[model samples]
Target: MANPHSDHPAHLQHHFVSSEQQFDAAKMGMWLFLVTEILLFSGMFVAYIVYRTWHPEVFAKSAELLNPFLGGLNTIVLLASSFTVALGIHYAQKDNKKGLVINLVLTFLFALTFLVVKYFEYTAKFEHGVFPGAAFDPHGVSHGVDYATYNIPYARQFFSIYFVMTGIHGFHVLVGMGLFTWITIRALKGEFSSAYYTPVENCGLYWHLVDIIWIFLFPLLYLI
Candidate 1:
């Protein structure tokens, strides 16, 4: 921690001249990292579009085996978690530690809810043998829905794509939960304030990216 400023903040690193500079630099870095994440997912999206274009029926039919209700529920949970993260950042900016801590905890809980819902969704899919690649073998029927009926040609490709795309997205959600947990602990320790809440802000941006990715994922994997 090198400090040139006689009034330099403790959190401000030695390399940065001012807190504003550090904040801007961090934000720019986060955006750049997010761009990489977008590119990473974009390749998968392109693959999906190409495959779907080649076999629209296969994709549509394969989608039937998916539980849109669970997907929609997880979407709502992630959106709410993003909102909570935003609120946490707002409270941090206002120097309201209690508000910030509460919101961070809430955000963590929402993230946990998302993962829990996703767990059930994954388990149900597994129960039906709806796995990726060669392992795919949709079978059985608990209700009126027959999983065996969904075993169409190129359907394996659709499930593979579904698992890959959603699987990566789910991994991000898990990471976000970890991030929120760490941030919540820091918030409780009173490490953040208006003068320096960069971690809180950065974590919020990452969570927003996670939610945005899922927004694209839900429609591509579930509805359409």
Candidate 2:
């Protein structure tokens, strides 16, 4: 009888000396990356909080301009995606290649849906001339489309921070899409197995971090 372990190929890195080691390394690196990501967004959040404190009225008025319904929907969408991503990692751990692929594909689709919703949100803002800086001049636009008329002095400043925070978050989503795409291709080729599924696990961590960031962002930017 042939040895089952021997059947597995050795395309993985030698630095780790074992599949589990490589997987652990990947997870650790991902956590480090997530820490850096948090720091990156923290700066923006701090700025928002300071500005909100200085101009509480502006932030309050700006909050009213946003539709909590849409924000709630997006929050649900992201939470579901996070659950799917977690399941994908579980499947990969069991060496259930088919299950892993299915979950990953579903997660990718969820990401796409998120982008679509975001597109509509961004379009609505643009049509109303609610952009940052001088572009935010809603000279002759009507508020019949999106609720709450926006023309306050500090309202523009509030939107400036809003756009910057959400824009950066959206950019992260785009980057994650590319990362997951690469992981999916690798998975399709049977690259990950019970012995070596670090890529899947690592990517899963990355996905979760993305979700975590949005959790805070939703409330701060939408609710509060």
Can you write out model 2's per-residue Cα lDDT over 1-224, one digit (the tens) per residue?
57545644585564556666666777888899889999998998898889888988778868876778887888888888889888888888898888888888888888888888889988877777788877786544445543335677778888888888888888888877887889889899998877777777777888888888889988887887
Top model number, lDDT: 1
Top of the candidates by TM-score: 1
**Residue 108 deviation, candidate 2, in Å?**
0.7
The TM-score of predicted model 2 comes to 0.90
Off by over 4 Å in 1: 1-6
Local error of candidate 2 at 107, Å? 0.6
Write the residue-wise lDDT of candidate 1 on 72-186 in tens digits. Answer: 9989888888888898889999999999999988998888898888888889989989899899999999779989988889999998998899889889888988888898888
Name model 2 segments beyond 4 Å from true.
1-11, 139-149
Count of steric clashes across candidates, in order: 0, 0
RMSD of each: 1.9, 3.4
Can you give the TM-score per candidate against the true fold? 0.96, 0.90
lDDT of 1 at 174: 85
The residue pairs in collision within model 1 are: none
